[model samples]
Target: MNDFYSVTAQPSRPMGGRRGVFRPGHVQLPVSGVTPNVETHVAIAGDWHSSGYWARQALKMLQEQAPGVRTLLHLGDFNLTANVPWSAYRRNVVEAMTASGLERIFVTPGNHDDWGQLGPRFQAHPNEPYRLPKTQTIAFLPRGYRFTVGGRTFLSLGGAASPDQGKRIEGKDWWRTEEPAEADAARALAGGSADVMLTHEAISGGSRLVDDVIARPNHRLFDERGLDASRRSRAIVTDVWTQLSPARLFHGHMHVRAEGHHSAGRSVYSLAANNSPGNIGVLDLRDLTWAWLD
Candidate 1:
């Protein structure tokens, strides 16, 4: 395991990003605080699907677009395929992030992601954020994970149902752990509320785009069981949204950019996949304002 993390183990912090103290162990999922600022901003990224090339491009663009931003809240689909070069991916991503002036890219896993690799890590540290075992530069946010920055609270619940399971082989490219369990929702609901919610699956009935996607007609290619599971997963997301009531909710998986808002401050946005327009966004943590960087 002579990866980048191993090589940089000397004097490296136990975690990748700036670590902070949290509420006493009595509180569940207590969030650690970031260095607050008057205008703290972070990059909101869409699905990378585990493409190291896209990973590099996104970081480079972040440097070009938002040079001062040091964090990324990726909305899942960071798939890790067997074909990917884990070491090179780690090295290049770390280099690109450094060049881009980024601190850490927090990922919420998607349906296509290799959950088999992440499961044990999440189990080991279910109460807090943990560095992705092999590539410690990146952090994986467990379901119902919460954190705060610039006075705004953010919640990350990552996992989705793969409607195209017919095309993906289980244990190889697809995993049963893709869908969110009922307990995940309960854990997130227990957090009470958030100013922002980041998810991989669109919340059911939350956005017109999401509703239309679920109601579309030409999904004959997907199996009924997969569709049923997807509905259930979206229901879980919807339940969380209704319970937590985040002012802003953003997600990936539809790979289409569209947004719907009920009031001035409350909205649901869907981002397209990486390498496409609307894949990148800039969020002002101070006021919870959003700007599309593409």
Candidate 2:
């Protein structure tokens, strides 16, 4: 891959009509890809784990190797946003990414994004506490937007809370749920209208790693309620995935590249981030292929 953020736009395609504010650097239509441009490349990475070295190195590699990359995806866990005293390092990584001049930066917030210290804005409170680029639209965050990329509808769910967990944190009276946003996103995809769904947490069978290890100590969504809360989380998450269908899914959180192929249906690639060991996972957008940085 060449070190350039260039993709011959494919002819435009039919995108889901749902509209919201778009982030800067985000282009929803394939003014060119509507024709299905061949050999287009997009970059995917996740789980920074708050390590600046990983972010710096990942950006360097893209600058050198994937210069033609059309998109830069920082999947999630870019930093332990809750623990860091100040977000200088986090800002540095993102700003460095923008400096790369990739057309857009599509990100999903991870549990660590909460910065437990910052309060609910980290949890998608309409208040918008995080420092988003003045140019970007925080997806699914209160009033974020959705757009298509490379023949696929990339539905970015705002940082969300597990319904059960929200009830616990906000108390039953305060728990306001949208019946589960993943299902809503999935249904839009199932309509065969969208190509891919992007979110911070894995929905039901969306990703192998999230399904198998979400409970691990290292996995952010593991319920603070412990083993006993297992029922609550699954009941809320699984129902949504079951009701909706999605062609492909990508996620970060476990910080490992786990490839999932299901006889049940579509294939999903769970990506890890730059801070995890060797670097982050990178996917070839043309054929939906992916490989982890060794």
Candidate 3:
């Protein structure tokens, strides 16, 4: 059990409301407990990147390590690149999860997951199934989506700017929509508070230990893109936290395990990359207690 450092989110300033604002789709799924008197376990992981091999291995490990897990929550970066077609990515992920005997999965999209590019693809391929069985999985949550399981509410907002975009081609590997719009953020906050918050990027305001783990060297090609991107992400997460005031937050992007806390007893857990062995966050829905299975 690792100790977490506590920090407090500053109060959010009031912003004027926008009329006729577009809101992302809200999804709610129902999950049943397998047995009575047993705590429903939810397994959380990060950055699977659609690697069939990795997904297979990771899910198998999860089953072995946390056999009681009833649901799976992914914190994003599920695909290798935005260049890959959404159909291919979806197929790969579904097949892998099915093979691993994982039925229920909820995911928030990361930068590499092509956060914003799926709209047109869905329109173009009208017959292609984009969503899985709601009872089995909620494949993708764009932004401002919330789902409930075992009497606990989880809000998920997914998107992150890619510092490595400089090395990739536009439309093929990079997308401008990797970050959420201001309106999207506002809409997410308007949904009110949640018991647990899930996102692709960790909040910027954390203890020095967290800062140290998230800091990355600047790339010559992208200059300060990494730093700038992180700052932007931090601002968004900060706003979300200040407004929603969730008791617990889980995110994935840095690909390292770290934990932090807020003055109000809000715990923040950043998970390790899902492709790695033994990287899973186990949550006890009965009491909201969580820990790393690794």
Q: How large is the C-alpha RMSD of every model relative to the true structure?
A: 7.1, 9.3, 12.0
Give per-model TM-scores: 0.83, 0.62, 0.76
Model 1 ranges off by over 4 Å: 1-39, 217-220
**Which of the two, 1 or 2, has more TM-score?**
1
lDDT per residue as tens, model 3, 54-156: 6666677666666555468888887634444655656666675666556567777777775445545433542232344433354666577766665577888
Model 3 residue runs over 4 Å out of place are: 1-27, 30-39, 80-96, 119-138
Ranking by lDDT: 1, 3, 2
- By TM-score, the best candidate is 1
Give the lDDT of residue 55 in candidate 3.
Answer: 65
In model 2, state the lDDT of residue 110: 54
Task: Return the number of clashes found in candidate 1.
Answer: 0
lDDT of 2 by residue, 67-121 (tens): 5554566665554333454367756665666666444455555544543433345
Sort by TM-score, best first. 1, 3, 2
